[model samples]
Target: MALCVMMFLLVIPASLAQEDMDDKVFLFPKDKHTDHVSLTPNITKPLEKFSVCLYFFRDFLRNLNLFSLASPGTGNTFYFADSSSTNTVHMNQDSALFRTNMEPYEWKHACVTWNSDTGVVKLWVNGKLYPRRVCMKGSSIPAETSMVLGQKQDSFEKKSTTYPFVGEISDVHMWDYVLTPEEMLQALNKNAHGNIINWNSLLYEIKGDILVLPKSRCPYQITSKSYVDNGEDVDNGEDVDNGEDVDNGEDVDNGEDVDNGEDVDNGEDVDNGEDVDNGEDVDNGEDVDNGQGCL
Candidate 1:
């Protein structure tokens, strides 16, 4: 029975561990040496060109590694990272620096693509493309590899905690070839699927302090809901209140019955006069002057 059970366990495919992680995020709560995520791509052949896309958010003002792919020979086979002030991308132990201003506590979308024929590297941040660079011309990234997030792997047997990632990361995808601009936009809009590694159907394992949670915001869903809510608010609050109740019930009717001298003896006219004076002097004239001048 023990032999049968062992055989059953051994026969279990590694793909069985994969889970659909659509609309989910990997939250790295803090920078810990042991905290990391292992990604399984099951790549059978080496890749001469590839693209990687992910969205990340950080409140910590420090450098962090976003993606790391390590092979038997090269540890920094493909590494993506960013600092508090700038961004850096590594391919085959060669790296390029990008002087892009990073806003604190803000979520950012980054996509990187590399072609070995020309050794050209391209980076897109939040749908904006950065200047192109080249590295490791004609080199191919090996397959049967180990990939991780939240930490950088230096070698097949060793990993580095230097520039460990903190905060949240989501929507990770990897393609076997460089994505076209349209495909990149589709990926950014969450409309494209990756052939190599799909976020919607991901094979990943958390090694340490990583939490898989629902993403905080869905852009299209949130925007659509907001438009619906805004429509309802405007229809109910503005049209009904301003057109019918406020205009007819309060403004027109009450203007004639109370404010158009009907309630003059009740101090309505005197209060109106005072309000008008205050409005013109303080609210309209001085307020605008002070606001424009001070600003």
Candidate 2:
């Protein structure tokens, strides 16, 4: 009888265990027809530290824009606040875009962790560290103005509702405390390991990737492309048996049968559990089989 035992254990690192309790996740509307989603105070608190992570995809270059309010009454504007010029993060006012260009389909992951005491903000993309610039004394983000994705929140001179984000967004998670680069990377990686120092807990998890307002909140579409198979470049040796192939010697008995020219039961003739051939069987000994015939 054979007995089998199996056990399963899940080892969660201290870092990932901390963010598991964090609350404060939200998904913006996917209105590709519009330019922005209101980043209202009701949706987000003011003056308090928080973090936001979301996956974003844009089909048209014009539909890719990030809008925020720097101060009260200053009005919402693009992160760069310019349409006539081009920036590393911004695209032309009229350009066709698609999420396919952005590897990993959707914004595989994006996160913003901030600290008020030090006034430091960290952004992460695809589990990798991103550049950051401190907000000067008066340039800090205001609490009143709404935040918008895909397009500028505040109406600008050339603002048009024609171009909007046309991709999917998902796996959005946020925290109130500033997460370390290591912690942020773990969260963005979606791996269940890593340390989150001062996180308050998750706020929400907006399921799905489309928003149409009242009927749905955000305006966007969910379309997936076929996964491309990247061929392996490294060479693994070809399949073949490389072990030594040897032949048995005739005089050595080599487990051959002498009675009828058939292989012997133990490399030598044996009868009734005892060697029946001549004493030659004992003299030509190599290795004998116990109860079983030698091969």
Candidate 3:
């Protein structure tokens, strides 16, 4: 049962193997540090109305790039950056929305949903909705553009490391439509799946000394359900009272009185109810006669 819970709750995580991932980081010198994710088609793509979400845990209070989905010269430019530790949301040519509550050294669920028709952008941080307007304002993201992560992109090949991300990022998802606040909350629970980028089986490339780390806590969990007995029975998959248990509505005596009873397999019943569930009950419904009853 514990193993089943563990399986549903976690998959042992790719970040748990980050010790081996060190060999894959760009490993640039500290004097000139750089860490980024070079976007392949699967990482980022152009869309008119879209929403993207990711889970990030920053290790330091430095500037960093979260996502850079923009064309340098001729397309709609939309980007997110942690400039000087201030989470800045940018769209189009130099328009930006600044956010100031993101904490360093913590895991955060960040989501941005945008629509080109209205140029409206909605940012969700850990499931809280923050709405804005008219940033890109009727421009479509270029189909073939430079998309990068972990560093602010000045251009396709030219990215600024002044805010190079130093930490772990995971659970990235992108949908071609704006996600509602409830849907964004579901993302925090890892309940929702992205049609564009499913983080469970993601394909991307990481650069520099950025190390992927396991999430500090499991993103999903199963809560024990309460039985029908109201608060009368514990929710440990069993019900001892009027409530129905997950196994069935089997009744269990608490032994508070001397006549308390135990679970009946082939046990006796005082009411002559023939608690008999085997033999004829198990064998062709003949009779209570011997029919070689097996559990």
Which candidate comes out best when scored by lDDT?
Answer: 1
Among all windows of 10 consecutive residues in model 2, the one with the lowest summed lDDT is 286-295
The TM-score leader among the candidates is 1
For candidate 1, what is the TM-score?
Answer: 0.71
- Count steric clashes of candidate 2: 31
* Alpha-carbon RMSD of each model: 11.7, 21.1, 15.8
lDDT of 1: 0.74
TM-scores of the candidates are 0.71, 0.41, 0.58
Clashing pairs in 3: 26-208, 63-163, 64-163, 229-243
lDDT of each: 0.74, 0.37, 0.56
lDDT (tens digit, per residue) of candidate 3 on 1-295:
9999888658544332212221122222232246666554442556788888876656566566677775757332667766434567777675656565676644577888888888888777777776565666676776666666666666655666465665566666778789987888898777887776666645456565554443333222223432222222223333333322222323433433212343444233211222222222222322111111100
RMSD of 3: 15.8
lDDT per residue (tens digit) for residues 1-295 in model 2: 1232222112332222223322222234465444343332233444445566654433334434443333445443223221112222221122211222333222345565555566455556566655553432222344444345454433332234544445543344445556676666666555422121222332221223534221122222222221112221111122111221112233433353333354434333323232333334321332221101111
